[model samples]
Target: MHPLPQLESYAIRTFEIDCNQQLTIPALVRLMQETAMQQVLELNISVWDLEQYSLAWVLIRKRIEIERLPMLGEKISIHSYPTGADRVFTYRDFRVYDEAGQQIATAATTWLLMNLQTRQMSRIPAELLARFSGYFPPVEMALPYALDSLPPMEQAFTSRNYVVGWYDLDFLKHLNNVHFVKWMLEALPEETLAKQQIRRMDLLFLAEGNLHDRIDAQFQQIDEATYLHQLVRQEDKKVLATGRTIWV
Candidate 1:
């Protein structure tokens, strides 16, 4: 079997940080993309050489758990690899650590290849899967997480609404997870925003709503305890996604 690929490294870009002085979720997602690309390169089948192929990797669903987000000035080391493949999804794993090697977060995201022109998922090419299977690494204590549905929608919280926009889509052409967090965070009262420091958070994506899709964002909490937020499609009342944040 091939050895696990070397960990990928990147410096935090200023534009990737939010006003909170920490790496935003969207930026973290980019880092995941960067490392995964490196993993693809190790197999000698990266997209850079895909002029002959009409298919592309697409992000389907992701479940991330962050212990503490990296500060603006800190650098992070991300170790990632394709863990395994299911019927239609190839699972990729990630381990993020600070400069001191203290693990900050662990996550797993699933991806599927899509025909660029057809825009539909394609089967996992056997050769491609075989090459990646050998590079699987040892599972860490908190390996890539398997996301579960939000415990309950509990309407006990305050809620606000916002519409989706074109800019929110990623390479997969749907609402990126970070954009969901942004809209939900915005629902917090200005006073709660004054001294907020998120210790950890989780995002659970459900149905994919389109541009101009009005979403109802709800939240309720006070005095530094964990806060819960949920995003739902306003018209159908369908839950779009859910998020949780622990702050001080």
Candidate 2:
């Protein structure tokens, strides 16, 4: 049973805050993702290492529940560990705590190792999975399920379209998951953002986007503060990602 790796003493910077003066959903998600990357690198397997075998890691699904968004200048600690792997899916857990040690947020994410050249799921090496040994944290809840198809809209409540550029790509040469959340948030009117704070989010990545790929982003309100979002390939209309966010 190996101890979970942790990124501690993170100071919430002013630049990381949203209009509401608290950590933004995209920023928080980025921190967790960075933590996961660090965990794997500590095991002596970097993204370039995976690339040598024509492999890359892709996030399949994520569910984040934030009890209280940390504010500017607060020092926090993030702990994460690979819970286990099943087939081609690897599950990981994350916990965030305030300076006083009070828990503030938790997340569970599923990732898949894939053949970059073929875009097919790849099996994780036994040695790679063995490093985790005995660090299996119980999931706070079931991981998010795949999003249902978005119902047809007379027109997108709010939509944005743009081409994928170099800045949008991660090491995998595809849209970074945090940017998906950022684009979704950007679709909302300024007034809506000023009045609400995102508290829960579930995202599922359906397809990958390549450099110069044109993306059509759409947002539709599900209720007062819940919205459904989708990103599609403009040329083929293939859905790239779908997500739902709940705000308070």
What clash count does candidate 1 reach? 0
Q: For candidate 2, what is the lDDT?
A: 0.78
**Model 2, span 1-248: residue lDDT tens:** 53565675688998899866788888888888888878778765567767667877788888788889999888889887777677788877788999999989988778888887787999987776666645655544324333344344435654788788999999767888888888877887677788877777777888988899988878888788888888888899888887778888
CA error at residue 131 for candidate 2, angstroms: 2.5
Candidate 2: give its CA RMSD in angstroms: 2.7
lDDT of prediction 1: 0.72
| lDDT, residue 42, candidate 2 | 79
Clash pairs for candidate 2: 1-134
Instruction: Give per-residue lDDT, candidate 1, residue 30.
Output: 74
**In model 2, which regions exceed 4 Å deviation?**
138-158
TM-score of each: 0.74, 0.89
Candidate 1 all-Cα RMSD: 3.9
